[model samples]
Target: MAIKKKRQPKTLAAGRPPVFHPRPKSISRKSTKSLINQHHLLEKRKRQAIAKGDKAAETAIEAEIEELGGIERYQQASLQGQRHDRGGDSSKTLMEWFKPCFAEGQAAPDRPLRMLEVGALSTQNVCSKSGHFEIERIDLNSQEEGILQQDFMARPLPRDDTERFDVISLSLVLNFVPDPRERGNMLLRTTQFLCGPERHSSTWSLRDFFPSLFLVLPAPCVANSRYMDEDRLIAIMESLGYAKAASKTTHRLVYYLWRRESKCLGPESPFPKKEIRSGSSRNNFAVVLG
Candidate 1:
């Protein structure tokens, strides 16, 4: 529950995003946490079973997950927890970070910034407010109206300028992926949907704010994982041509704004699984490329 906030300056230094995670005083929080953990554990096991070519094990795991009320139940619980978290929505943090950089309508006089929200829990978050962004929300399972029920990976690749977005949010998403390599692939895939470097708002007040990624993850994924830390995560992002625009760390979450500075070197066979830290209780969270 003690986190050394590495960088809370620039885009996101002052605000505290829901510290509801890791605190066990309330029954609701404990049950939600346990449910999420169970889902994650089962998902990991299913991945492992598939890797070993054990169809029987995979089938059994799927049945177990179904008995636990399936993926829909897990997603609903997550969405509910986000709504109930004491520290408001994650979009609030994303909006705060951009506010300091872009002067709203001034930056884009003709139109609003385009944003793609992956694993979107709701269509009613603060980000959906008019005049700032033309937002598109996508989740694998839709809990409500307006949010597209689709898998981000399977979503059609943009064929023209109209489909690409200025900003893409992977909020509390990448960590949900069971495979580290798949996580890396997912990160790479986002770049393709983002408007190219030419579309970056250079003349705007906060140059290069567009064509950026707003990423949020549970603190443990980076802070306490055996294979990942802030440094490692930054290195991976840098290799993908994203420079750290701003960062903030809370008791339960860490937030980042990765400005897509240079053109990404897409999909190189690099960033293999390497243990950067070792401990008894560290989680096996990693993002391996290729």
Candidate 2:
């Protein structure tokens, strides 16, 4: 028997098959475009944060971008182009501050002072003029032959006490750390390289830290009402038993020189600030300089 033919799907007026469009395909394109736009927005914000020396903001933005699956692009973009010198020979010029120590025979003149430059992009023979400093450079984005690639924050201390440095320079380094507690930890970590007490000790004597810490902070952040202002930083260092030796402000940067103070404080000095309380005790202890 001739049964009724099943109803056929309708075609276009021209008798051509209807074009099939997957809803997901269009939705995916729209979502991709949205993410790209968001990526761009985050990038712009990150740049602004860097320019403003707002490291916390930059870090937060980075975390957001990473969550959006754009970390690879961000990393590639960050590594592109020739690395430029952040702060010039000013650091070298400042080396003169320590000259008195050498001239007075407090420190050995024969052996060049061992200096560690953290976050270094280009080698600055700051100590070359006097042949007084033997510099070791390290950076997170090392692209050169001599600079050791490392995240100064996460890297472990030298196993041997003798391997520690006589001086450590953090030139625009702390600001790059995303967490305020981590930034404080970076300050505390400086003691690891400084000519100080044994690293293994749970507590450190204030007198043990003999190495000088040279720091360069962004001028805007130092002067403005930011989370990492100069005053706050000075307080943190003071809490750590570091007394300011000299401070100067360049057109765009703030230079600080600190020496470990001889003053002794009871175990309970200035307590750890809020940011540090939740972090590793090493960080908290470092901040307290106990």
Candidate 3:
């Protein structure tokens, strides 16, 4: 009985491989070269397709290229007319360029003034083209070197404990913040920071903040149905002690000159409640903070 028990042989289960398994193919220079060649062929095909106006194929190739380089970098590199030269005008220079927009009764200063520009990069070039005054630029993302990096909603400005700036330019930045209250807060903080604690004390009121502040916003901001209406925007500014001295709309852009006066509150609607006083010979509007 013991001798008969040793006669059975081993067998693999049905549909299963044998106990011995093949090792995986290793990545090698030859394989890598083959892959690269395949990629090049695919790219050539894509180019040919694009030349023929085959949109779907072109899109597929673009997607592949984007995957290789990452979408953001690819977009940044390929986009044309992303940057424009504004002739090296600083904010002060641009102020003069826009000075014709100022209404009568606004004050004009004789000296070079400090200006802060938010969300302005190429516009700074335009500003510089005017050759007026020194301007400091702040942006969320800027390719230009030496500009301050900041997100209006997240980062607070540098606290230098001095009311040093004469002009703060916020152009095309407010609408980016989706919330009206937050937008109002950002504007308030900007004014408060520029005006300093001496001017921003709780008891001091709006007049203590500034004699005049200039604000420019896009017309779409007023017409946007997703956020606060123009009336709400005006109310928020007025509640925070800003009065609209003058506002003008051209095409899709709406420009506002807000004044902080000792006695005047802001307007109740998008319409100007008072005539804006033009300063000097320039048409630029001014807000009297005090």
lDDT of each: 0.82, 0.60, 0.50
TM-score each candidate. Answer: 0.85, 0.57, 0.48
For candidate 3, the TM-score is 0.48
Model number with the top TM-score: 1
Q: Which ten residues in a row have the lowest lDDT in candidate 2?
A: 279-288
Q: Pick the candidate with the highest lDDT.
A: 1
Off by over 4 Å in 1: 1-27, 101-105, 206-208, 267-269
Cα lDDT of model 3 by residue, 1-290, tens digit: 55655645555575576588775343343443344334445556776797799999988877776565443332233121122321122234335435653435544434454556776555435565555446777776665675777765565555663434645677645654533344555666665535432332333222322334556554544554433345655665676556675666655456665655433232233322223332343321212121
- As a TM-score, model 2 comes out at 0.57
Off by over 4 Å in 2: 1-87, 102-110, 197-210, 262-290
lDDT per residue for candidate 1 within 1-290, as digits (tens), equals 89977974555533656556563233366777788889989999999999999999999999999987798778766866676454567888888877755564554434567899998888778788745888888898888788899999999999997998888999889999998999999998888888776665555655646678999999999999989999889889888878898899999889998888777856444888899889899999899986
Q: How many collisions between residues are there in candidate 3?
A: 32
Ranking according to lDDT, highest score first: 1, 2, 3
